[model samples]
Target: MTKKLRNAPAYIFLTIFAVFSVFPLYFMMVSATNTSQEVLGSKLLPGTNLLENFNNLVAQQDLGSALYHSAVNAILTTVLSLIFCSFAGYGFEIYHSKGKDRLMAVLLLAMMIPFAATMIPLFQLFAQNGLINSTAAVILPTISTPFLILLFRQASRNFPHEILEAARLDGLSEIAIFARIYLPTMRATYAAAAVITFMAAWNNFLWPKVILVDSAYQTMPMLISNFSSGYVTDYGALMLAVLIASLPAMVIFLVLQRAFAEGITGAIK
Candidate 1:
């Protein structure tokens, strides 16, 4: 009981923080169900206009297309990042040499530099490569995130090196060892990386906005932005778009959360 009392403050702080995080989601749901007028009327309660808002949002010019592009970009980015980051991380960790260690240091340093400083150069490079105004432009830069590599490296540290030796005893080559042994054995690490990578790709805004100039290439985030403008912004429609944009990520997290939670635990053994 005395120990529990000592931890009471931590529990209180966590409860407060949880409420703070949840309030906005509640607010968004309520706001999405009401009209711009009702929202401005300062009602935080849900209304019956949810269906109407959905209709209006879907009715927005090229909304379905925008949502499709955003979904596609996110899926492609996450998939590629998982494959590349996982391989690179496992390789760098399991196959350490002075040269590769220096290369890893370079990659870590690159993560320190803000993408904003490189935006112009990145855009120019994409243009030069004929990738601008395409999904490739949006995905190419994001698919190789340094942050994801670090995450995988940390998880890989938990793997048993003896497992590698055992696999080698079975006459497995380096590539075969990773594919048949390491990858299959590290499901949790993959899950955690996938969740983070998927969320990052889905929520990315600046690069998508910069390169995807046309409505065909625009995402749900851009759609929400356009909806938030001018004399009479449809708060309900805007909220719906925001709501829609958040769903894919939510679904992903909810579905994979168990795997994500377990992934790190398994890796440590």
Candidate 2:
């Protein structure tokens, strides 16, 4: 009884925190299912207007194209980043040199510069090249992230050099070894990278907003922003759009959750 009493405060704090964190998500889901009129009320329960809300949002503005563009940008960026960053990471770790190390240090330092500072130059360069208002603009800037390269470098340290030597002795080329051997061994790391890259690409707003001036090329996030704008807002439709927009990131995380956890553990260890 005394021990239980001692732990009561801790349990109470945890429970309260959990409720606070979960309530907003619960409210979003509930609101997404309610009518515009019903959403204005102070009800915590879900209503039977999910289809209606979705239809209303679709009717007012087409999210289908936005979703597709977002997917393309996110998937392409994730895949390319994994390839480039992983290759760079593996090279840096396996073939270290003082000059290369200094160059890498410079690149790491470059990451410290805020994106806002670089945005104007990036926009000017793209505009000069006639790439403004293109989805390529959204994707090109994110093709390789320095943080991901660092992640890959750290993870590559755990790889066995003996396996690499054995493959070389067997006359396997460097490209073959990396693709057939190194990549297979780093599944967890890649999974984690995929989750992070996909989430960032999916949720990226400022760069996309500034670069993509055409309404035709607007992404899901842009659509959500516009929904909240205009004199009157459709609360239920906006909530539904948010829920839909959030689904891809949530699904990607859930699918790769196990590997994601394992990757973090491996990186830490």
Candidate 3:
């Protein structure tokens, strides 16, 4: 009876979790399919207006342009971060100087300092350097986040030192070994970082809002923010826009599907 009761709890919690997780997705789809009026009336059943909502969303926003800006920025941020962070991680791990060790301590401290604390001073510095309202202002400030650096460093700890030593044995330069040998074997690491970086850049809100002043430069999040209004909020169209905005991150995770499992598997190994 006790063993049966233990099994009963697992089934109950799993059923509850599945419903909670799936309900939002179902509602989003239902909302997207209903007319704005039907949505306002709180209809839960899926309607026939999915395409219509999509059409309305396309006509309402410059979906192409907004997605393009988002894609470009996200790609840029991901690529630069992968290269720089991986290199920094490799350097800190491989070199092991006292100064670099101290810098790692500082990096940890920097992560503890809230972004809100630095926002005013960062804004002033960017303005003085003519970086405000520029893509650089958004992309550059975030390149060396402590979390990412530490993530890469942890992965580096698992790397086989013999490989690096062998490269040096063969007289290969450090940079060349990092580029050619280390990176190739560490594809899983890079793939894991890519998903996180892409999602971060895509959904980044506050700093982008501060720096990207032009309407053309606004992200999907900002677009969603302005979609709702005082008198007439088009819930169906808003849901459609959100669905579209969520696609890239979804697609990226789908592409790096293996990396999702890699972390868990690597941990056990």
Q: Which candidate number maximizes TM-score?
A: 2
Error of 3 at 184 (Å): 1.5
- lDDT tens digits, residues 75-101, model 3? 899999989998988888877789998
Candidate 2: lDDT of 35? Answer: 80
Superposed Cα deviation of residue 251, candidate 1 (Å) = 1.4
- Sort by lDDT, best first: what order? 2, 1, 3
In model 1, which runs have C-alpha deviations exceeding 4 angstroms?
1-13, 264-269
How much is 72 displaced in model 1, in angstroms?
A: 1.1
- Per-candidate count of clashing residue pairs (backbone under 3 Å): 1, 0, 0
Q: Residue by residue across 1-269, what tens digits does model 2's lDDT show?
A: 99999999999999999999989888899999998777888568989989988888998787999999899999999999999999999999889789878978988999999999999999999999999888789999998888988888888889999999999999999999999999999999999999999999999999999999988888999999988887988889999999999989999999999999888777666
Residue 106 C-alpha lDDT in model 2? 89
The pairs that clash in candidate 2 are none
lDDT of 1 by residue, 120-205 (tens): 99988988998877988999988988777877777788778999999899899988988888888778788888888888888888
lDDT of 3 at 9: 84
Q: Candidate 3: lDDT of 138?
A: 84
Q: List the residue pairs that clash in candidate 3.
A: none
- Backbone clash pairs for candidate 1 read 188-263
